[model samples]
Target chain A: MLLTDLVQELGLTPLTPQLPLDEAAGIERAYVSDLLSDVMGNAPGDGVLITVQVHANVVAVASLAAQKAIIFAMNRRPDENTCLKAAEEGIHLFSSSLPAFEIAGMLYRNGVRSLKE
Target chain B: MQLSTIISALGARVFVNHNSDTCEIDHIFAGDRMSDLLGAVSEQMLIVTHLSNQGMIRLIELMDASAICLLNGTPPCPELQEAAENAGTPLIVSPFGMYESCGIIYSLFKEDTSSL
Candidate 1:
């Protein structure tokens, strides 16, 4: 499904939406972890990342993997300058108050399976 | 998804503006050890870690990832920031602890995934 479709379904309005990352950028798949290296080594193409470690390096890794988007969970958020950087890079970012397991379960139920699969 | 949207979603604060390095993200890899990030390459991905050392900045430069998202509200130091600025690395700082931050991200991804 399209990313927009998923957004509409979730009834989520991006708190800091920026430039688009389309062109068949499918984030339907997910790679959930707090290990930057793990994701760099294992995550598949078009996988949306879910993590708690917020750093500029995250963008570097994502850029290499060619990910679909990034989600910062647990009510965590980035700073002002970081947000603008994301906009310029065109990396889609999101935040939530939920945990990894719950979020994973939700995505699993919706066909957004794990990289392990 | 665009990194700005993640910033918005998490209500996060930013430290650096994304440069020509490309801000688009699709994958997330969180870790503090630079060694683990050695071979893994997720184009346009995000690296979630607490390490704000200059080495990390250099790694990002070598890796060419999308941006960095720091956990526990920890941001880069002046040295790291300067390095990031010089290298043109994008960065974000979050308030939640590591585990909780991971969960929150998963939640949002699932939110959109479930609909599909």
Candidate 2:
């Protein structure tokens, strides 16, 4: 599904619109982790990342992984400075009140799958 | 997704990267030992560890990771943060401990056939 579709359907708060909304690429896989190494060692490129980490480094990791978007769970938001940097990088970011587990369920229902399996 | 987005998900604290340069992550590799990171090569990877210091930053720089996550609520000093910014490596400090952070990450990223 398109990112905009996911946002509209799931009611996720959009932090940045840097990424192209129409592309279906990188939307299927969803990786959620706070551990940066697990993400680097295993997460498949492209797809949205779900986690509670709100920092600039998160932006770097997402960019390198070629992820399509980032969904911050638990109603947590990144600081203003981080958001500005993300906007500069052309990365689309979103915030959700739902926790990771619920978000995963919502994603699965919406046709999103994991890249690892 | 841009590296910035992960910051949102992790609720991580950004120590540097004022320019917000667009960066993508290919994958993630978690390990505290620098030696382990050196042995592997991947595209745009994120390094997760509990260590936060100049040595850790050096390891990240050598690994060419897109970003670094400092777990256990440990904060890197200003010098290390500066090094990361100069190196163009994003740095973040997580509130949770390393193991908890890893577990949280694993739950969301790990998938089963049901999602399929």
Candidate 3:
């Protein structure tokens, strides 16, 4: 699904509004994890990440994992510096009131799949 | 789902079995971060993670999780095994990677809910 479509469908609030959402980039898969190591090793490239981690290191790991966007579940938001770094790295950041599991389920029902699928 | 069913589904080896054959798991929380696991874990949740350490054993004890399944065939260290044995927590080693392990368990969950 398109990043914009996801944001609208999930009612996610953009953290880095300065960076425009990519129209051509479609997220086909998503990985839900708060572990940076797991995300780095297992997350699909160019896919979305659903996590509750708000630390600055999330940006570095997401960038390394080649994630196009990150949705921080449970209304968790990173600091301004982290958001700035994510924007600089071209990774979109969003916040949602729903928890990670619910977010993952919603995405799954909407045709997003796990990496193996 | 029973812990035994999950072990068989993943072709996992049981290193520390504590009534896992009949133990029922109602949820699956797959992650490597303890902090995330702490917040997400619910009753009868089976934790599927790549981390095999004393911390994991402690988490199982603290949260009273049904079981802990380590992925990628990674064996738990002697200390971790001892901890699990002492705490009576089931420890399993899955031959598949994290993604595949979660996928298999997710399919089981989907089937379970579909039947309801």
**How much TM-score does chain B earn in each model?**
0.83, 0.78, 0.89
Give the top-scoring candidate (DockQ). 3
TM-score of each candidate structure, all chains considered together: 0.48, 0.48, 0.78
Which clashing pairs does model 3 show? none
Question: lDDT score, residue B34, model 3?
Answer: 79
Candidate 1 docking DockQ: 0.07
Candidate 3 achieves a global lDDT of 0.81
What's the distance in Å from true for residue B23, model 3? 0.9
Worst 10 residues of 3 chain B by lDDT: B107-116
Off by over 4 Å in 1: A1-117, B19-22, B114-116
Model 1 agreement with the true structure over A42-82: per-residue lDDT tens digits: 66667777665577777678768877677775555767677
Indicate whether candidate 1 or candidate 2 has the larger TM-score: 2
Q: Which ten residues in a row have the lowest lDDT in candidate 3 chain A?
A: A99-108
TM-score, B chain, candidate 3?
Answer: 0.89
lDDT of each: 0.64, 0.67, 0.81
Q: Summarize candidate 3's per-residue lDDT along B26-79 as a digit string, tens digits.
A: 777766667778887787778877677667867866776768888778788888
Model 3 - which docking category? acceptable
RMSD of 1: 16.6
lDDT of 2 at A86: 77
Q: Which stretches of candidate 2 lie over 4 Å from their true place?
A: A17-26, B1-116
Candidate 2's residue-wise lDDT over A1-117, tens digit each? 777778887798888755556664437777666556666665567777877777678888877777767888777788887777777767788999875545755676666666454
lDDT of 2 by residue, B40-112 (tens): 4466766676567667767756666677778656678888787788777878776654434544444444542
